[model samples]
Target: MRPPSELTFRAVALGLLIGCLLCFTNLYFGLQTGWISMMSLQSSLLGYLISLLIPSVSPLTPQENVILQTTAVATGTMPLAAGFVGIIPALGLLDRAKDGMDPIHVLWWDGVWWCCAVAFFGVFLAAPLRKQVIIKEQLAFPSGTATAQLISVLHKIPPPAAARPGLRHRNGHTGSEDGYQAVRTVEAGGDIDEDAEDPGETDQKREEIVRAGWTTLGWSFAASGSMTLAAYFFPVIFAIPLLGDYLASKWLWTFSPSLSYVGQGIIMGFPTTVSMNLGMLVGWGVLSPLSKKAGWAPGDVGSMTDGARGWILWVALAVMCAESVVSLIPVVLELLRVLRANRDGHPEEDLETETEDRLVPMKWVLWGTGGSVVFGTIIVWYVFGSEGIKPWATVLGFGMGAVLSLLGVRALGETDLNPVSGLGKISQLVFAIVQPGNIVANIIAGGVAEAGAQQAGDLMQDLKTGHLLHASPRAQFHGQLIGSVLSIFVTTTAYSLYKRAYPIPGPNFPAPTAYVWLSLARLLRDGQLPAYSGTFMLAFGILGLSVSSLKTWAGLQGKWWAKWVPSGVAFAIGFLNTPAFSIARLMGGIVEFWWRKRTGGNRSANITLIVIASGFVLGEGIVSVVGLVLRTFGIGVASCWGCAEGVCPSC
Candidate 1:
């Protein structure tokens, strides 16, 4: 058996195909919701099934499946690293709103290079983390562990049923789902050994295992796409003002039916929805009215400056910043503990699992690490120029990315959580100090850190899966390189396509996360704090820090009420976006919660709705992309609200 081809042509081709699909899928979702879920099982299973479905192609080896996921996962993160979903689009938002400042136009190649600058260093840096985190420490990279177990069972390879995680998100968080159960049904019935089941039972059970998510995923996608399409023709049905026209127009509290946000909400979860609702109450319910009544010169509700929106934006940033910094302390300490406990964080581990021959070469690591930073810095310098970010600052950003990548990898290993968003806050603060009042420098520097952490964390997680399946680290690394090279074009084009379709940061594609980045950059550059905003920032900041600290401490102490505490990240996002968006998402979470509770947490019961929710996201997002393509050749309705109403000036 010719050593089970690890990085074969078919695997790479299919992986690239699925990964590009996901790149578009995730970017569309991430822009609206300010978050993106991991698509490990989604991508891995897609490859496995596709290979199985094809008669001519060989059955997917466990190692080949790992490559499929590695490529897809790596490629999926590019839109974010390239700053399309957040920082880059935010520059457009900041430019449009920030009066008297020269506008920064980010071209297609600029986006590609900007993404390149921020993404590759992390991939190279992740190589060293593998031994430390996955091998010696043997930290549960829970999802990676889950994926390995699933692949083993699927291939009829005897796998240990022990160490299975109970039902949770594909990313290992309990918050979201997308046929998470289908890809990870091992959690429900334990590993499926062929010898243990009845005659022809294994295949039947496998179909039953994946059918709920697999079938519903397609159906729900089509259904949601239909809804989005129907809404395009009848905008009134989509734009319902449940709170009446006044609050809907002025305060952004309308109940506009959007499947994209609802699907995002389902993935984000019930607790996050609660936090968002709370944020809505504080931001729109109370503050917006008060700011206007007190003659704060509040303009439009979504205004970035000299409006009620501007005032809450500062408060949200402060709270988010405080919470992110506080949460990151424990993660940093964990990495420190690993380093201090073991000399070079590599005490000892079994060599049977990995010999010198299978692991990545030392020279490759050194060259990749050194070369990526230098290359990324030059790209940043060339794209943004001195007027944007200086080379010294670019180096600093990438360095922080490398360091944070370690912490990110560590966090993912232990908890299966990637705190890239919060971790990136550290870069924003550093850049604020390095070049105060330089908005472009502030965002791009932060973008570098966020982008690096995201890419590195994702790659390490993929590496963890490879490690478990006895796949070659070298093969996975090369697969990742191919994916990264592909993402440069795929994600950049996706960004441009979406930009042309609608207002980059306008309604429909609110770009909630981008608003988060934009608010912070606007603050650092303008230095104009709303009246009494200092008090608000201070109070909220302290509260955020305290709440996050207490939550962490409570979790350690195993307190019953620990899970009840609001997520600081979700709360900040609520403040950043509209009430309708959060409300729609709340509906999704509520549906999932109802299903889980009604079925008493049965895996099969939850799997159906989870699949539908996933479909809703892909369905609506992909439809928008399709519409964009059709319209380029002059198809579909002339325009939606953005173009029809003169709401989006650029469009």
Candidate 2:
């Protein structure tokens, strides 16, 4: 069985199930609070990484491969989970004709449709792109790196044995031992034409190739697992807030109202730095000194953990999500398309007269695709349209979802404007059309923001990994069906209950971008938000993005500096994500480069560093997972000790 088909099935199934639940919960919270709640499953990317490590019962089949791929693609984009709000508009199921829909209902069902749409897009849109962009361009999509690593292993071989047997001849021919001893007596060397192939050499070459395959599989699994593990754990050790620092920062200002060092780390500028340093002071300086004075513990793990953890965790999560989608998707689709084209031999194009040896069959794709459609239809019918949706509304939602996916793919391409993100935008637009009340508007907007912020980059990579493994894409899709079903039911129910009791306040300003549109819809109903300033900001931002004079100049010049400068500026901006984080990363990169150069490019050292970095990634991810779990239980953490009692501290 293929890697994704066999090993990834259960993992994909469970992950998707959990992810869907997280989205549902977030939707529920959005409705109750009149704002999006960051307490859903997706609130923590690190947590999901950990779950991937746990081995589960996999329904080993080619169909499972598609399920795994679909799950990864869906979760990787994460926006799809969060983007359910967009589906509301596409379906036209909201009661906008009479008045606005309720925020609570919108949040609960928006996610249901959003997930359905993403699953559809992952199959249909990605299928076509597999041939056009990925295979044709030979683009090195990083997401498929895992897949490539797996394939490279399968075609490898081991080294040949050293010894080979030779034919024995009569004594006169000097072939046997006795004849060889009588060197002088041997027959005159007649026809000493040595133009024969060496069996030993050929055997050795075959062995080497075979050995390569085993080595590749072993290494790939290890690397993949290590990466997942690192992402799971590192965040916890470094991402949580220091209790002492929290007390000092917030307590200095207000008693028993300390800030989470980790939370502050996520702030844009000085806040993160100040929060981290303060956390360190509490963890290392205050806590450590007190511990030493009290002679409680010898080591200072507390201080070490006290750095402004949450701030960096959130930012890193954002960056990781973005980088993952950007680097992984196109290559995956391209590779899969190439493999499929090569295997099946495009009949119309007359690409080939024969089919290539394939690990997976085309029938699996059809089955998986069919399965996705069925499951998706069921979800929409049962979940999203279960409300006042007319009987025909079910078909309408599904058809519209398909159409929207196509449009989204065209606009976003294999690289950007992910259908899932677009889904959130679309849902928000629909909510506006229906004019759900202000509460509904705020909830829907929050859902959109969360969806948009999800990592399109990761989804691309997950698909890439599946493609390279020769795993069944259809099976991966099926796994997605299982996961999504579980996730939607659990997360949604939990979040709805939380919202009924405690709702977060909406911002005075509108959501970042698409949410801005949602806010506009609300103005039509309540006229509560500022309109002119939001419009001005939008226009200015678009104008900034539109200026192509510089792009044209660079294109004309064809100068290296012109290209390098912009990239350098971008790097600088990225580095300023967080002072400590950027600095640490820079230092780590420098150390790695220097080590590689010193060792003459020793791979072992590189691998070691990768392992360590992976740990950091995992640690941060786990921390978020904890927060999401807590939120599901209606735990509004205000301080280290307890959560918000429906009071706004920031206010």
Candidate 3:
């Protein structure tokens, strides 16, 4: 096996290219069938196949192989542009489109929205941080970990000839005894692959495998499927109806929204989650000995307390305030560090010596970022801004986007926050006061509704994987464009079908953000602003910022409540969604958590559980997608064709 240090840029580059191809293939399938779960599975299989190919021409160390493999997995899973933006437009749901909508193909307006809104923003924001987050901080984005692990496992397989030197080590050593001794003698030595029986021989074998082709493809398939399966299935099974029913049985509130059975089940899942998370904050931060004795019964706090709503609001605000204070301190320190380093430390000047060998040049990153900005701008101008946008305005948007992105990196810890969630929180607060018609509220509300926390979390994980695999900031930035494009279409198509199948009751569900833009034909249309709502959104953003801050502070302070907050949010969203969804999700999470905790995070057991979860999720998702498609065709009558039918029909 070639040592990790010996793995060349060529191998890594090849891995990335193949990974992109594999991911695109999966996306194509997903679009056709409406099943996104294949994303991980396909990517991993491609990565493994790529590893085998690399071995044929060059020797590789296990680490090199793993690193290469990770790049592909991470890049492939990114949410790219798909048909999501087109759904409302295609379905004739937009305010302006009175003509009604089509079912099968995406419209021009949909593409414009994605190109302008998501693609433009995602690329604009993701690019600048490529240097700060991926290079400077060297965060271990986890997507690459899967690749790293798979490569490690495969590299351990014995080579036919043990004595033969395989891929050369980056440290300039070989498989022979003399080289082994020489390698060991060096201080602060390079990594040796524990999985490989003989690094050199393995490298040769890996190179041969790469040349052989089949093994490389096989590995890619396995990893991609495994990753996707785990991600897809686990979330659904965990959110079921059991817990929500119990919660509803106990609590009697006059004003509670008449949620469906599924929605109620989701709430049940959340109570534990929310209660636990909120309880953590109350117990550790509010009631702990540091402040004063606080415990509302270990892990079982009463749901109803004296003035509970008031207490919750006050605690929430306090946590938010504390978080802001804590976050500002580090931000201030980091700013100081930047100023000092730029001024007195003269770090940039000195960087020439170290940067020459230590890191990728900033010039390339800057050039690439600038180029993407230009390309993205032109796309927006052609698609949405057919009449043309002011040069200054476009430049300003790009510039401000960069700044916001940097702030996002520093504050949010990721640059891809959906305006939907932030706005959703604001809508909740506003609807409490205005009691506006569903028409006005639903536009923003619907937008945020489709954009969920899970998607946000997954995006961050993809970013993490990119970081771990040493992908160039430029590559990741560009890759995100690809993913965004794919996602837009996929989401839009699914959503359009949903609206058609089950027409929303209130004032026609307002077109999603993209539809608004597409209707206006770009350049910050007046109606798109929703001035009253925009002001509210600003307040909501502040609220979110506060919430994020408190969560951080509680954790740092070693407060008891930190653990339960996740559960709490889950509960809230679950309660809103469906009782069934909540219960299923909670059970799944509980089981997974228990297994992980008990086994000390054993790899095999975790993988096994994830696989099962993936199966369940995929199965459900497939049925849903098929149902949507069938509904689109006006085939409402239930038949004995697929699983959608009551009984399995024998072919």
Candidate 4:
């Protein structure tokens, strides 16, 4: 019989349900704000709670929890396949919406199949790199590691149990020989320790940790849920309106007293929050005033306006795209070095352990990747005729996807940032240069590349979690595949309903990412830059290149300043978003900093803090989704004052 601890129906179903909910939530928020919360920790917390409700079922094993999270993340991230809900529709607005020219029109499936096809390649691409990136290189996939630790603690399992004996093939370390040793190495920063002096003492300490975790989870849930409910009823009380009128001015600010942003700030940390604030200052205080003086920004200098902000975005996009290309040089070189080493008979340790059971089969990766490429090409060619997108161009797009996936996964493993948009911009630049004035082809190519890279990065992170729990790679792969398939349907349907309820670019749905894509496409199609655009582009591009160069230099010198240099991409994103969001995030970071100091470096306390912060984010997300649904049905509480005054279109 199969092992009782293996992947079970209950786990899969629970994971899918959680993923469906989060996917729906993502659809709502991604259109409304263009940002989505990570679901790994949230899924673990919710899954553990739901598992407790199953009658006559044994407790969930660490491996089972890993399966649950892997599935949920795959499902949750699927909404990104929508391509920001602006791309396909923007094609219509740009006069390229002909039946045979636009993918959505010809395919007649809202681009869902295209998204799935590209994302499938991501999973296959990530499969082979699991051992090399996670085990041998030991990249710090922070979110994945945290999920593994959460699973271990919640399941009340010892550290040794976290790493399955059957999966112990690392450097010939069998489960019976060094399973505990392996677990000890991975769980060094975690709470558990198998090599403690007293077995009984260690057990007692673990029990205490578990008890504390549960207690913290309960309070966090209550607090977060209550706060979210309060915000729903009294948004004005929770959100402090600032700056110009909400509807009259495209750029508005509101001091949001939401714990959700605070929790996000904590997760993002002080450096990131500070950098975001700096970006905000530059965008609003410095750039807006300068643009106004230049006679292009048609607004009052005293008030921040999106018109001025638009200039910054254009410049930022250019810089971000350039930096993204520069960043890939090292990754490409590293990959080439690995290939040369393997060919020279000095195979990396990961390549040396080529047993079938320990790694994903090479045949599956090659066949799956090849099949996805062929299918994607057919879709592109069918949607857009040879004039719009040649077969070779389609092939080239997927090649870019493959390369970007490798780079994206590596970046995520190191920094917990996928750089999807940056990679997309790279694709857009490449296609723009190759197929000048072909707006339809350019956008499609970029979207496809971004979708592929996004999925690959997500899968690699899941693999990291699986590695930590010693879960079967095959089982995790199945879970991810199932989740991805389900997400395609669920998210597509959610987007449809959301669009019908509140069309994008409306007051309720900003669709920021989509707007960015549309603007870039227009600029490329017109072949004319806005006045002063080149100046700002050159300036920001130099700034980005300089910063990247400095970062590389610092790394080589082992300088302390390397860690403090804020991510240029983060700064760009922050500048593009409303300043109020940065303020809210800063508030959250302050809370986290205080809590950490109060805890005096207690691991258990830190875990509790994370759980609580995650609760805040989850609660806010769920509440916001519910509110949107209610608004869609016209059944929510009385409309807010802004809505009543004709400012909120959805309301």
Model number with the top TM-score: 1
lDDT of 2 at 106: 41
> Cα deviation of 395 in candidate 4 (Å)?
2.9
Tens digit of lDDT per residue, candidate 1, span 51-74?
A: 755555345678899999898877
Q: Per-residue CA lDDT of candidate 4, range 493-552, in tens?
A: 776666666655555565555656766866776766656868888888888888866754
CA lDDT for candidate 2: 0.33
In candidate 1, where is summed lDDT lowest over 10 consecutive residues? 174-183
Against the true structure, whose lDDT is highest?
1
Cα lDDT tens digits for candidate 3, 252-277 = 11111111111112212222334333
Better of 2 and 4 by lDDT: 4
Local distance difference test values of all predictions, in order: 0.70, 0.33, 0.34, 0.64
Candidate 3 local lDDT, residue 191: 32
Error of 2 at 41 (Å): 20
Candidate 4 local Cα displacement, residue 548, angstroms = 3.3
Error of 2 at 68 (Å): 6.5
* Per-prediction TM-score to the true structure, in the order listed: 0.87, 0.46, 0.51, 0.83
Candidate 2 lDDT tens digits, 1-651: 334324453546555654553344334322221122121111112223333244444212222333343453343333234343232322222236423553334465655454553344244334434434333443233223322332222222111111011211111000000000000101111221233223244445645543543354345334433442332233222222234445333221111111111111111112123322333333334433444444443332221112222112222222222322332244345456656987897643422211233223456546654565566546544553445332243333334444444433322332222323324334444544443453343333334333322322233333444454444444444444454455454544444443343332221111122222333344445644221223433442333233222422342344433322221111212211222223333343345445545655333333333334333322333333454455456555343232122222222
The TM-score of candidate 1 is 0.87
- Name model 4 segments beyond 4 Å from true: 1-5, 85-108, 135-138, 156-191, 195-239, 243-251, 299-306, 347-355, 380-392, 552-561, 636-651
